[model samples]
Target: MIRHHPDKNLLLEYASGSLPKGASLVVSAHIQMCAECRAQYRTMNTLGGSILESCAPQAVNDKAFHRLMGRIDQAAEPEQQVTPERSKSTEPMLADAPPVVHKLLEKNPPIKWKTIAPALKMCRLKTGQDQYEVSFHRLSCGGKVAEHDHRGYELTLVLYGSFSDSDGVYSPGDFLLREPGDVHRPTVTEDQECLCFSAVQAPVAITGVSGWLLNRLIPFRPG
Candidate 1:
């Protein structure tokens, strides 16, 4: 189950084709695995269409409506089958996955290196100046991350294994969001390594001894 979701406002921006390609890719993937979100997306799309029609003085073109209906029908066709045996054959199956999943897993924007701690390493995917940043963090088993607070929105999506904090346990595929001012210390599971993709709006404020050490050895600032 999805532990966190993009708010209705974000979904509306996506359905209206206003979101950037990279951000839209992530949102689309979340909607595919979440039925509630999918329903909400449909409702938003309908509402947006109604608003446009209400504001426009000219009548809608019959040919344009027919073309749009055809495209929708094509998108609704049944997905192709994939055998379990075939799925395991590929190292990366993102290409063969659904459109939304494929887009999310696409190799683009490139990740740049950033050291978090001795036991942790991060790579940031640059979006733009003063905008959001996505990062891939690799944590060694039993490693403890420095306690930190977010200045803006922070979304963490677990891609492998699990971790825990004061609030609760987060496992693979779990989506967690920490709004501005939220702080927590995350500890990786002793039995396995933890890998997460995090999206942040601002630099994290590290605290305590661990933070001091990390700050001296590596740049802990946001990308």
Candidate 2:
């Protein structure tokens, strides 16, 4: 069972189509995994339509509207399916992630994972947007990332295994939002490795004596 979920306000923002692209992507993935959130989003959409219908009808620019619809139709075309490639060193299957995430993965597969720490590996997924950095993090059994706090906001979805912080443990399908002033060190459970996907608005601010050094040496990057 999933213990965590994005709050109602974020869901409303997503339904209203005002959320930032990367943040919206995270919320969309959560909605797909959680039936409760999906229902909430659908209800919100229905309510929005009713509200719009109640308002006075506005004049339409037919040409502009048709152009927008054409672009949307192109974007909705079915994506070709090809089995994702995997390297022997890769920790988990891309199949483990939500379907929406597949749009970012390369068709060639064998995702390039970087070793940022002894037991930590990272794989970045390009979003073609500058406002947020999107990536996946893998921590080995009993491993933990350095204690740090958010500089902006972070939305992380657990895709495999489990991890724990000061608040509580998170398992697959758990969605966590960390805003500024929030701090935690996540440690993977001893039984298995933990894998998670995240979209962040800014680099984290690591805490501790080595924080400055680590921060300088390993400033977060989209790659």
Candidate 3:
């Protein structure tokens, strides 16, 4: 199981349609597979609906409303029957493909992987001008990600294996949101490799001797 998750604020923004398209897509995909996130999204939706209802309403033409209702009624009817050839053509390809996990492991990502510490691999998936950047991190068994703090908010989603820090142990489908003041040292377990997808606004500020070595080799953008 992968451990990690996106920040609540980010999820709220996504539910309200305020997040960027790319980030929203990622969150939507994650929510599709994560029941916890789905619950959060439902809460956000409820909150948004309340806010919308509190606002003044615009007048609608009576004829327009009637026409819209008629159209909706038509749409509610069952779809026309399909022929065997048409049914086959309309079916989704690779209908059984695993969720976002496979897509995240694309060989040709916009950002290429750069070796960091021994047994650690890092790759940036987006640039900060986009409001957030995603990073793909792979750590071998027993690997350490070095203690670090964030400048802006950081969202981590575990896709494979697990990692632990001061906060707690995170496994697959777990989400974590680290604000500016948060700091952590992620350590992978000895039994399996850990893969994580992180979205951050700034680079990680590394601490300690091991962190210094990692900072030098990782070529990460400074916070």
Candidate 4:
């Protein structure tokens, strides 16, 4: 069962399209797997639609419309463009993979995995902006990541298997958020490997001697 979830305010931000793209992507992935959150998102969207309908509509100026149409007409002139064909490999490997996850991978071809540690491997994803860095992490069972904290904010969504930290155990579809001051070590106790999608607003900061040493070799963005 899914134990972790995004708070109401985060969901509200996602529903209103106010959350940053990197954060929104993780929330969307969670919504695809969590029925409770999906229902909440629907309710929020319905409320938003109702509020929008209740607002008075603004009249468009005729001159502005004509100018917009003129620009559109000019752009409509034929221009040769090439479109690449999407490959079948773009499909998600997991049967229950979230739509947003699939969509993301479909646009940005998957990257080759590289080992950062003994049991940890990761690859980057397209964030479209420098505001946040997004990536996929896979940790083998019995692997324990160094205890660390974030510089700004971090969102992690478990996509497969399970892992545990100071707070609790996170299974597939679980959503975990850590702020600048929060610190924890994630350990994979289950026999299966853990796969997660993570986004960080700033770089992660190592606390201990071992972490500090590893910090130099691993480039975790700093706030």
lDDT of each structure?
Answer: 0.63, 0.76, 0.62, 0.76
Which stretches of candidate 4 lie above 4 Å from their native place? Answer: 59-95, 220-223
Clashing pairs in 3: 1-172, 2-171, 2-172, 3-170, 3-171, 3-172, 4-174, 4-175, 5-175, 5-176
Model 4 Cα shift for residue 184 (angstroms):
0.2
What candidate 3 gets wrong by more than 4 Å, as runs, is 1-10, 20-26, 46-112, 126-129, 210-223
* TM-score of each candidate structure, all chains considered together: 0.66, 0.85, 0.65, 0.81
Q: How do these models rank on lDDT, best leading?
A: 2, 4, 1, 3
RMSD of each: 6.3, 4.3, 9.3, 7.8
Better of 1 and 4 by TM-score: 4
Clashing pairs in 2: none
Q: Residue 38 in candidate 2 has what lDDT?
A: 73
Candidate 3, 99-203: lDDT as tens digits:
442344343344455777777787765432366666667788988877787877766666567888888998765777778978888898889888776677666
User: Which candidate comes out best when scored by TM-score?
Assistant: 2
Sorted on TM-score, best first, the list reads: 2, 4, 1, 3
The RMSD (Cα, Å) of candidate 2 is: 4.3
| Model 2: per-residue Cα lDDT over 75-102, one tens digit each | 2221212224342334454465665666
Give the alpha carbon lDDT tens digit for every residue of 1-223 in model 4: 8889999999898777667777777887888778888778878877987998999988789998897575444222211121133334432423455666666677776556779888799877875757777888889898998777888888999987889987889999899999989989899976888889888888787778777677777775411
The per-residue C-alpha lDDT of model 4 at residue 199 equals 89
